[model samples]
Target chain A: MLDLNNIGQRYGKKQVLSDLTHRFESGVSVITGPSGVGKTTLLRLCASAERPSQGEVRWCGEVLSRTPRAFRAGLGYAPQRIDFPEDITGMDFLLHMAALKKIGLREAKSQGRALLDRLGLGRDADGRIRTYSGGMRRRLGLAQAFLGAPDILILDEPTAELDPQTAGHVNDLIFEKDAIVLMTTHLAESLSGRSFATLNIPMAQAD
Target chain B: MTLFFESLATHTRIQLSRHLRSPAIWILALAAPIAARFMLPEQGGDYSIMSINSAYLALDPATIGLQLGVIMAVILTPLAYIFLRAGPTRRQPWQADDLTPARRTAQMLGHWIADTVSLWVLMLVLGLAGVVISLFRLPLSDVRPIVTLLCLCLIAAPALAVIAGLRTIFSTRRGLRGAGGDVLFFFVWLALLLLSSAFFATRSAPPILDVFGFAAPLAGTTTERIESLVIFGPASSGDVLSLDAWSGVMSGDYLFSRLFWLVSVGVLVALFAQIYAPHKFKALRPEIVTTGPPSFSKEPVPLASANGSLISLFLSEIQLVLRPRIMIPVLLIVAAAGVVLPFRGMVGPALALLLTFPFSQQAARWRGMEMSKLSALTPLGSSAVFVRLVAMVVLSTALCLPSLVNITASGATDQMLDIVAIGLGLPLLLTALGYLTRSAVTGRLIALILWYGYLNI
Candidate 1:
């Protein structure tokens, strides 16, 4: 469970989120806002990647501040614009994430192979990442997030670059997972189910 | 086989294209050597030529091979990394399908081989030029051994590339800043210098010794004897047990030393290549957030209050520096050059200044980018933001101050100071100029050209 109290974040003088309180239980939740609203920033804050100016974020009754390795152990985050270490292969990357997550090498290898196979990237397992399509990269991102099977999954614009089929697949994957799924998206069609509670961010007024 | 060859050929061409695109790097790699060879005067007279030839002949083939190999390795290693990473960044042309680990490794190796071949070809051209020039001053027959030595050097080029590629893949730093390659090259060069000095010191050779005596395949009567003596130094003891074999000994005087190094390098290359796996798709994940929207209220947020976020922000900053994108190439280039350029002769100042120019621009741009991002969001005064940005820059510079100081103390204080001035001051000026001109690239270009002119003057 996640709780936000008095979450007031400002970009200079422009108040983005003002004294807002919210609670996120175990389920899929959608964070929606107009362009330039702090949807991405808010998601980042929850992922422990960003900090709120005047607020407290508590995870499971403890005030979460740092994105501790242990905390990150239970958290899987996917950014809107995905950037990866380009020199490593998709399989290698999964293996690295597995290692970071303290997964056994043998298990990691098998899991990596399985993940790639499941994502239909088995054929290109040995290929360099530079050759992957936008959709494929997005899928790869999803695959990595699922590697640890973390308790909380935060995906920002998860389906932005993906094809509709891939997006649907990702949505299905999110739905199937038992973890807390928090996603931010600009597209309305991407969110069809009420499985997620939406938080619409208002635009900043002109100074 | 055809498919392999076709893939290799296409990859090689792409690698070459990428290398050629960087005109500055291309000039440094190729033209610098050519220019050096032409500018330096050749040792004249038969004795000088013979002495130079003998020196060349006395050099272990493996040692020469390793030296040439290391050079080629340094040049090509970063290129391999860059080539591998080129796709997502869109810095170079790479097809989406080319992202497989095996294909990427094969492509990198092919490219390295191509680079090695090009380097050797250039060496050959230089060697031929040397031969033609030497023929006018001495009997060509006497310099045959030296020519053979040159051939040995050429043969060793591929080995160097392999070694370099392996280092780049496995080592934390790829290019010039890589400790493994740089340290190896350093010890090798030092050993050669010490050995040469010890040999001459024992013989009580004159300071104005003939240059040819040092060349490989010692020709003429006196130099041939010296060359043979040097070559036979290891074999003369008559006890084969005293000699180190390549397989048993890690280090020592023996024919095996060179062989051992080559084998080691080969093993390292194989290991690195095996471990190297290029991903086909990038995992889109935010690692950390460095800057957040600033507080607009007049009340100050205590440092202790936001300790967690502050720490996270600081760690993220450090992580940004550590990220492979920035760290890998920087380390590689620095490693290749080693502690300093060996031939710091006349062009040292110009080279140092030129190198420092980019560093300054990078620092300024980093600060500017952070400020721009922050300014876009909040109504916080630019002055406070600027102060914070400057503090960050200063802190970063402070961390690197030790290295800067060491560089300065190394008898290039003037050059070091000049570099710092240009590197830091120019960037600040450019950042300001960028705001006025509304064009960062234009500001940078003007600053770069101005600095270049200043250095030349």
Candidate 2:
């Protein structure tokens, strides 16, 4: 189980989240909320994109503050915005991510190739990412997050900038991952038939 | 025309206001004149142009202004250019609200005018402050020279614009991403322009850039034209009053020449603007396709079998440095220079600088590295990441191996170890400094100083 206990985040004077406490078991947990409601911040905190200002986040009863590097490797994150190296191929980008995760180059290459093929980006593997379409870029972001096979996969606004059909495919791909999935979405109705724990966060109070 | 003028005024005001808030701008603008006034030799035995208005020597009022104007413009233009950038440190993408090419060009001209005027305003204030101080501290007479210098500097507004206009045109042509190169190009071009006027004394044979040179005209004909402005001074008047003998406050007017130079430079600036208007700038800074997936060569990255995490970090950092096309030729040239430059004593220092190049560049290009953010998240500790970054510098600097072998073959062992020490040490120092400061300028400045010192050895 992943636990977010009394987590709060403040950027200067503005409080983005306050006294947020939650526990998540090993399955898909969709965090749904309106904009500026700290959904991304919650996702970030879970992904070790941050350490909570007020309280500790724990994975499997181990406080994330124990060993940050180890904690970070266990967590995979796909940010709301993608700003990857535009000159490299999707395959190359994944291999680099693999290396950052301490995966050996041979395994990184093969695994990276497999991930590309699975994500339907294998044909465009040789092309620079700058040539990638918005949907393709989103898929590549997901592919990169899946690199090194983290135990917890976190994605924020993964369906953004994609058409409904493509968005459905992306959503399906997210659910297909074996890891404990944590995701945020603006369109809660899109997941009407899906069975998962839904966490709703209210809009943050102004400072 | 009203729109153009209006846009111009707005840009000037905006640029000026931005710079006014920066203490860097204030120092760059005002510090020199204040320092010069204080540093000028009290006894004034020196007859150099720099000390013309000093206590011991007195030249014509107009000559004083002309000297101060030229020096002030040279110092302030580049500093102003640095401080005036919208995003000097990082590359900014094109914004929707940006002015159109033609209007932006006009606005840039206005912006340059503002920078020049600001320099004049600050310079006048400092000059007056200095004169008041000089009255008490140094034995001096006549506020006319200081006042006259201020007027001349103000009159040379068009000349300053020529310098600033070239900067604008270059910046527009290169885009914000390449503006740093344009800044360097401006300075180098300035140096060469000054040197060319001396080498090719005959004005008839204009070099490729001499057309632009005539617009600013600081060293060559500009000085000749300005000399006539000091008609009352001994240098221009000659026979009766030697500069040494002239005591009282004296002045002359350069209104006609100032107007002529101003008009001439203004025409060149207008031409420059039209030639490099945003649309034309698109031609100048053509979009480059630098990479195409690198064709996926199966060449081993030297760490396929090495399973250590530190080794992985090293490989990634090296990849970042070698990836850019802009860096490759410079590395090749440095290697070539190391091998081919015939001088014996010069080889070591030159190679030291050469070896430091990639390291310095890597330090500057840290943002692009995978280790930058992910290191904190990965199992690899911060120390391992730091070591790997330093290792990239050490390993890449070994590109000088061929040149190093050549140096040994030529039998210059007196400073061989010393050369190698400096070659390795300079980059390491720069890497640490660059990482600490997160500044490209820091790395470049350290390299410059290191090269300058070792070259003199």
Candidate 3:
């Protein structure tokens, strides 16, 4: 379980997320809002990628800040803007991420191949990310997030810039995961049949 | 023509706004004049028996102008390339305006104008600061110092225009874009400085080819102390001069030479831009086709046990640092220089010191990327950073090997230890400092300064 108690985030003089309290169990939680409405901020806060300006985040009663390394062990995140080091091949990047996640090389190779094959990037796995197109890079981002199948998943706009069919496959992968999933997205129709909770960030709070 | 002017105006505003907001620009603006003041202290101030500042302080207005001009020249010359490195036009958003040749010319002109305008503003601030410093250091009756400094600042406009034009051409040219180009420019600046110092020593008016316009102005000054000017040497003795009304700077020869170089460089940039404009941009290509997602098997592969490999992480870090293929040839050349140059004394060690610039920049970039969300979220966390540090140390050691081989063969444990310290220590220090400060330019600048010091030592 993940718990947020009155979390607030400010960048310079601008307040992005304020007094946001939320709880998550093992299920999909969609954060929906207009552009610049702090959905990404909320998701980033939950992933422990950024600390809240005020209040605390707890993962299973352990404060995230206190046990970030351990918390990261069970966390999987895909940011809204996917930025991969351009020089490394997709397979190499995943393998590196796998090593970070404590997956053995032998197992990582198999898992990376399977995931790449699933995402239609098997043909280009050995090519550098610099050569990969936007959609291909997006798929690579999703593949890494889904690498170890950690207990908590925080994905922002995972299906964005993807074809409808690819987006549906990504949605299925997200819904099928037996973990606490927190994500922000614009496509509501994609998640219509799935049982999930919605967190709406009002437009008024944005700068 | 209207559209061109409109585009130029729009780009000028955008670029100027960006310049105003950049912390680097602000830092340079405040630091340049302050550095100048420190370089030229109060005349006849108390100093140690061997100190040069006392002699530098005793310089006439022409020498002072030359010093100020050198300071500004070095700062502004590299700045043109550094700004390009930081903000590459290739990264700009694809706009419809880019398709029109007139608008493209306008955009390039706007960039040049913005650079010149900002540089002029900085020069004015530096001039005012110089005047303020003069008020404290000089008597009110001696305004030649003030006039000389201000006139140099004005003469600097033409010099800066040329520098900005060359920067535009450099940007447009292929194979002259990265650290290679920057390193080349540094040598070019050194050559110009040498030539200018030679002209000053000869007491001859530097012809229209004076890249740094100050050479001609200093040559035309009334003070016979021009021969005492040294390119990177400690201040030698020169007879102290009493206050005299110096009007040599207002001469037509100096003004015409500066104008001539400025117009030549400006025309070259315009012609080069027109010639290369057609081949500059490539059409966006379509991406590869995506296949349908794979069918998921009912029973999934079991999760792998939690046991990360530091070796893999280290290798990936090495790959990241070595990503730019140019570094491969550069490293080979550094090693060759170390081998070909005599291993005795400082020669080999000096070659090893050269590796610090490229490696530190690459390492800083690698560490800088750690702050990003993509890497920060990874479970390896600080362990990955540790692995990268080890990687840098290993690479630094490899760079030292050519120097190390000679020291090792000589049986001089002391020199071997010295090689190891420089090899493993400086790059690590520079890279860590760069990461802490989050500016590759800071690291590169510090490395070069330290490298210069090490060479002189």
Best by TM-score: 3
- Candidates' RMSD to native: 19.6, 8.2, 4.6
Cα lDDT tens digits, model 2, B74-180, are: 43444434333322312322342144543755665665676656655665665565455445543365446545545445533544555455555554543432425
Interface RMSD of 1: 18.0
Cα lDDT tens digits, model 3, A104-168, are: 77888898887777776777787777677677788888888887768998988988988787788
C-alpha lDDT of candidate 3 relative to the true structure: 0.66
> Model 1 residue B232 lDDT?
14
Checking candidate 3 for backbone clashes, the offending pairs are none
| C-alpha TM-scores of all predictions | 0.37, 0.68, 0.83
Poorest lDDT segment (10 consecutive residues) of candidate 1 chain B? B240-249
Candidate 2 positional error at B443, Å: 5.3
- Candidate closest to the true structure, highest lDDT: 3
lDDT of all predictions? 0.47, 0.56, 0.66
> Cα deviation of B128 in candidate 1 (Å)?
45
Local error of candidate 3 at residue B108 (angstroms): 0.9
Candidate 3 chain A weakest ten by summed lDDT = A80-89
* Candidate 1 docking class: incorrect
> What DockQ does each prediction reach against the true complex?
0.02, 0.23, 0.45
